[model samples]
Target: MTFSKPYATREALEQTIAHHAWLNEHAGSLRLPAIRTVRADGIDFASIEGRHARFTDAPAVATVLGRAHAAAWKGDLHRALLTTAHPLAHGHELPDFVSPRIAALRRHRAAGLVNAHQMTAAQSLLAASPATPVAFYKDTNLRNVLITADGPVMVDLGDLTLAPFGYDLAKLLVTLAMTYGPLPPATFTTSLACYNQPLLGAGLPPVTIGRFLGHAELHHLLTLPYLGKSGYRHPWPTVRPRPEDLT
Candidate 1:
């Protein structure tokens, strides 16, 4: 199987390793494995053996991934709240391709299209939300998670960078939609239920959580254009966008 381009920095590798270490250290609380970095080809790699979490024959692997992702997002959110003096201080850079809401609306009108325009507009809304705090993930997807007997272990951390809090959830949702087809409404609701509880517990306002989800969704939709062009294969099935799905 092909892997995406290797993670470029030692710092990225270390951050991922640290996340695993944290998970392991709090295994009783988090129930994830402690993974260590292994050096090879001048790049750092890590592994969580197959024996750790078993989803091989599980029909609900997707659901498992969904919950794991929700849990992880909560963990990250909690950490962001506790350790950082300024919640929004986490440095998440907006990608250059993201169009502002006005521009997106214009693009929508000019093209008479909806999906792209709507996606862009949503992104703009996310950017404008003051309550949304950003955090970084090296790689945020189900593929990077290993299912061992112990639990799920997040493995890759190469592309880690801070972004809006719910960005990972959006990415995961989009991936699931793409991979498994348009998500059942139940999936989205269930995942959100898991995701929202923690944010509320962390004293985050509901609107902030909504903004984060919007950002995540927008980020996923906008990034769809460039997915397969990179060495990384698209994780979900590609479908022509319906006119309604567009802006």
Candidate 2:
């Protein structure tokens, strides 16, 4: 099968295997399925056996996102709170190919088609947030999540980072919004309520709830190029002049 961009590297595959094993050992409470590491050319490949859910409808996507948000909130408040704090290091920045794309965004911003302030705000939140939960999965897009007879199983670990609790939620929400337009306010509100209730039940502070919403919005804006016509259908042209070249 043809895989998406940012295909798993040997080192990344090893790290994922190690992480899965560590989680199994330390957090036996999580009922995750077994995963084996495949080494080829001294590189590791991910191997998991499970079905994946196809998110064709908004409600279905919302359900998965909501459940993930709630679970993240319940499982780790500190990390959730920090979702607005810690930013990934430059070397670990998203999509593993962001320099050029960010440059494109800069040009778009200069044209007043995109908002610079909003993008900056999102970056600031990510930088300020505390390190994410150890078990936090960053990329929660449809391509990464798989549905099995039992439940959803995430496979891609490329975007996994130690930055914030709801980083994954924000990522998923942003993708959903770009693909389907704005989410229903009521649905988001309900999801937030459900997310906060468990934390309240556990006597944790619910401060990050607002930050999560803000980040979700910002993520949508920053990732706009990857969705809609700019994405899969119309890729950025190769050999395009630099932003300075246009001047």
Candidate 3:
């Protein structure tokens, strides 16, 4: 996937190019496609070939996530990933994207699209998870991950950032809920149990895991409006949670 650097100066684009390169710099289960080139003369380009992700598919994404999380903890790649990702233009920001979900919520709130309770719920979520950074692909929905023959690879690391582990997990869960339906109770529970295995093994407090999941769920709600602003394209819809839904 290719994107034009929103900024005119080379400063932002230069940093983003580094983020692209860092994905390939690592040697591990979570490695992504090598960036062929990033053209900054006019429009930016970070291209790669042989994506061929059909083989890895959905389950492969989970395998990569489980492994990445575990490997991040075990080999201490977590710090390495964070160190490499920190120089990125957008790495340090909260919500991880240029258009952050919380900022989106504030806009909707001003327009009276959503009530304060939703904001309160979202705030509570943010308070729960630690603000620690990690090597995370901010966009992990099914479409972004490519199931390649070499291994399950993640594409579109453009949004890679140093953010809460739960944020990445929550974004994936939110995408699944939007694409499928309400979070599958049994499946969601099981998946978190699995995702948190590494975090727990790494010595994080047990309650922190629940906080990350809750924080991420609220992040989904916050992102809905921004998704709508983008024309509610496929996998995006112009909607927000009802009051009862928040409770």
Please name the candidate that would achieve the greatest lDDT relative to the true structure: 3
| Model 2 ranges off by over 4 Å | 1-8, 23-33, 41-116, 127-135, 207-209, 229-247
The residue ranges of model 1 lying beyond 4 angstroms of the native Cα positions read 1-46, 50-123, 128-131, 207-213, 226-247
TM-score of 1: 0.53
lDDT at position 35, candidate 1: 36
Judged by TM-score, which candidate is best? Answer: 3
Error of 2 at 57 (Å): 8.3
Candidate 2 total steric clashes: 13
> Which 10-residue window of candidate 3 scores lowest in summed lDDT?
234-243
lDDT of 1 by residue, 1-247 (tens): 2222244565554444555554343222333333333453223333346532122312233343334334444554334421232222233221222233335445554665446557456646545333344344434455655666655555554444444445555555555444445544455455555555555654554324355445554545445454664322443334323223332
Error of 3 at 103 (Å): 3.1
Q: How close to the true structure is residue 239 of candidate 3, measured as C-alpha lDDT?
A: 29
Per-residue lDDT tens digits for candidate 2, residues 1-247, read: 2232233465665555555554344333333445433545232334445543332332344345444434544444333333232223233321212233355557668866578686576455545423333224446665555665655555555444443444555555445444444445544445445445544554544426566655565455555556445322321222111333222
Off by over 4 Å in 3: 1-12, 25-27, 41-59, 70-101, 128-137, 200-209, 226-247
lDDT of 3 by residue, 1-247 (tens): 7534354566555555665554444426676555445566434444434443231143445556765655544444444333232342345321242235557778878987667887787765544222353535547764565554565566654455554565565566556555544543444455556666655766653324455456555656666565533322423232223324333
User: What's model 3's TM-score?
Assistant: 0.64
